[model samples]
Target: MSIRPATSLSMAQPTMEGAGVHLHRAFGFHEPRRFDPFLLFDDFRNDDPAAYANGFPWHPHRGIETITYVLSGEVSHSDSLGNTGTLGAGDVQWMTAGSGIMHQEMPKGNAQGQMHGFQLWANLPASLKMTEPRYQDVSSGDIPTVVDDDGTSVRVIIGDFWGKTGPVDGIAAEPLYLDVSVPAGLRKRLKVDTYRNTFAYVFAGAGRFTDASAPRGVLLEKEVAGQELNIRDLSGNQTLVQFGSGDEIEVQAGPDGIRFLLVAGAPIEEPVAWHGPIVMNTPAELQQAFDDLRNNRFVKSAH
Candidate 1:
């Protein structure tokens, strides 16, 4: 029942991607060991339609899985395999670009000119990198949502939580992805697997993660003079909190409550050679993948 301490905290950096679409990158293209088995995370939230309307054009991905979770907008997607669909609010699309696949995503805002969503890239292990490309689209109603007596709500996206299973399964990484919301001024303790590497992304509101050596609560908003807290306090939107080894996490909601994504995964402790979307074990293997794409042999598996 050890409580994980916040190891690092930072805000998502504003970055332009996907044909000039504006988005905030929490972490990506760096920190291999920081969040192993997970390669990238981006927060595509915008209130102005012009910022996201350009969308992501056609792109190829290999040896990775991209999980797109939409919160308020719609993401229309089409892949080379003749798969096409639109993800509305609360919908999730998990695309496994095993051997290879080219896809495009176009985002449309709501009537109020608002859009919000998240996309996470999980690395495929060496064994499954070239298996076959696949897609899993789960709608909002299919996702399990649980509410606790303390007003803490959790939406299990791709793993076990609160004795419930997520819609996504058979993943090599065996990751746990949860969308958590804590009510105002509520204190909650959530249990996590002791062996998994964990992190939390605060998308809305603020809160404090209690540390073993810190005072009673995590005060993320204001700093009091002479505060004898030896713990990390996390707050504000787009804040990323990386946790240390522990079996559980404790958080106290601020006056506005807190909402964040809690993600954990077993580290893929293997040698990694990564270049863009293609990840392999060696440089030669990466060159081989690029050669295959250039030779128009990217689709090795018949969809």
Candidate 2:
């Protein structure tokens, strides 16, 4: 068994998007290869209503899937396909922009004037790029939450874990998304597929993802608990921790415990021509998408 350690950690950056809402951008438009099959991650969490009320207006997306997970506030979304709905606390919306789609998302804080949520962009492989646009709206109650005896809870959003499957399926990336919480002083080893690239975004508390990646079938059990293989600086409030190749991950929570979203997927390993919201395999294809938008030929159909 190999333990994957944190390869890189970075804090989110404050940026304005969609009209004028202020949000933190975790990663985007730079060094995207490190996060293959995953394009960007944005934290739209805010305590002030004014900072998020403006929200994201109309936008276009193509050759990608956008996953929105709401934590405390509500997100009212409307797409060109005539789908309109409100996502309350703990709700998730997985929208696949196969060929093309335009949508808008407006956020409203809860009673206490707080909004917290995340949006992750997953790149689609070329085979499914122009398939069909669709939505998988998952409610909070529909998601399964598993609680361990040691006060550790995990909410599986996609893929199978602990004998339970997520509601969202048929995704090209076949990603595993989870919301995890570990109690103080608890050490846990999360299972991960060695074939996939994995990452964890810590939004609450602190923890250290031990750095002990063993090559192939080598067994280094003692190195997992040893100081030589531990990464001491992976605990950041809004940090993104990218892991190396390994079958499992070990995290030791701090006094406050740790809560984060663990996401992993198979790499696309294809050329990415990204321009704002549109992502294509080639530069010419990207230009054609923009040209189609200007000529009213972007979307394949309304429904």
Candidate 3:
């Protein structure tokens, strides 16, 4: 199997959003072509309640799908359609804002005042942009977790993995979203469809992603016992690793092991006109969406 080379590495940038909710953005608002079918990704993890308590107030979203996975604490959300729910640790909520919708998400910290989660925005193809809005809230217990013989673990969230299918289905992007943890000092290779755009976001511990095409001298190197050692090449926490074309990705865990989100999706390859949360194909269509919001006609099918 061909190992996908690490094309680029970047650290998540600290950003403030939704009434001053502090978070880190891994990728968004730029370079849409690199991650087609996926628009933005945010790592909203905070220990100070004041930093995240304000939460994402009511906002409008159109022509996109949002996937929110809670790692700690709880997120209570309500939408313009009168749908409301609370997502606890390990729970996931996938919301598709087809025509348009207004929603609000309020985060409540855990006992230790820690709130951690991720929000990914996926673009809907033009055919589905004007479809109906929908929600698929999967509880933690309902999602499947697969454990390997070598102590590696994987949580399949959106697509099939290790012969197991995720709880949420009927997604436009047909993406594979996995939460993977490798044992310390273990080297693991994971398969990914060759036609999809793939990226990994490291959130815990350290690891090294093997780039078959990179020259031996170019990677970050260190010295061990009077010998050159290429160790801990990956920056670990909040680091985004984008991969090149291939069918598999290889990662070697560091001394403390590694945990990350491996996400891949088929590209839509369509023109994107994005303004805030609303995404469309043409600028004029985006303007019409705003005009609809101003005239109280944004929600086409609120059910």
Candidate 4:
């Protein structure tokens, strides 16, 4: 099994969004082609209520899908289609803004005034960009979690993993989204499709992503058997690791263990004319989307 090397590593940048809601953006609004078929990812984890209470007011989205996974607290959301719901801890909401849709998300902290969750934006192919909008709200209980003999656990969210299938389906990208936790000091190798662009976001604890040919650096771990081997720096909370092509990824958990999100998807390989929440193939199409919003015809079908 080929081990995917770490192509790049970066820390999530602190940013403000949605009426001053403090969050960290792992990747977005820059280098669009680097992460094809995926637009943006935000870690909206906050412990201060005032920092997130204002929440995201009404916003328009088109030609894309938004996936929100809540780890703590609750998120109350509503859309222009007259759909409303509250996503509690461990809940997930996958919303496809095919034609167009206006929605609002308000976050409510838990009893401890702590709110933790992630939002991922996936780009839709040109063929399905104008399809009907839909929503798949999966509760925490419905998501499957698989455990290995070594106490490693994986929560399969959007694709088949460890012989279990995720609850959400019919996505154009057919991506694999997993929440993985490894026990302390355990080295684990996880399989990934070589055809897909893969990335891992470390959110809890620390770990080292082993790449045999990685460049030498102060972060490098000890050489094995006195042979020249390169290991990536220990990745801790809010770190993003982009992997090179391979069928598997190997990592060593630190003392406190590690918890991270491993996400991969096929590349769209098409021109991306994007502005704000709307994405299209060309500038003319992007302009037309805004014109539709002005003409009060953004929502093609409301169900």
Q: Can you write out model 4's per-residue Cα lDDT over 65-133, one digit (the tens) per residue?
A: 999999999999999999999999999999999999999999999999999999999999999889999
Give per-residue CA lDDT, model 1, range 186-224, as digits (tens).
Answer: 888999898888989988887788877664544566444
Which lDDT tens digits does candidate 2 get at residues 1-303? Answer: 888867777778999999888889889999778898899999988889989898899999999999999999899999988999999999999999999999999999999999999999999998988978999999999999998888899999999998889999998999999999989878888999998989888888876777774222111121334444334342358888888888998887777788999999999999999999999999999999999999989889775
Q: List the residue pairs that clash in candidate 4.
A: none
Count of clashes in candidate 4: 0
Return the clash pairs for model 3, or none. Answer: none
TM-scores of the candidates in the order shown: 0.95, 0.92, 0.95, 0.94
How well does model 4 score by local distance difference test?
0.90
Residue-wise C-alpha lDDT for candidate 3, range 1-303, written one tens digit per residue = 899998887789999999999999999999888899899999999999999999999999999999999999999999999899999999999999999999999999999999999999999999999889999999999999999999999999989999999999999999999999999988899999999999999999777788887633112223334576534443558988999999999988877888999999999999999999999999999999999999999999857
Q: Over 4 Å off in model 2, which ranges?
A: 213-234
TM-score of 3: 0.95
Q: What TM-score should be assigned to candidate 4?
A: 0.94
**Ranking of all predicted structures according to lDDT, beginning with the best and ending with the worst:** 3, 4, 1, 2
- Candidate 4 residues lying further than 4 Å off, grouped into runs, are 215-234
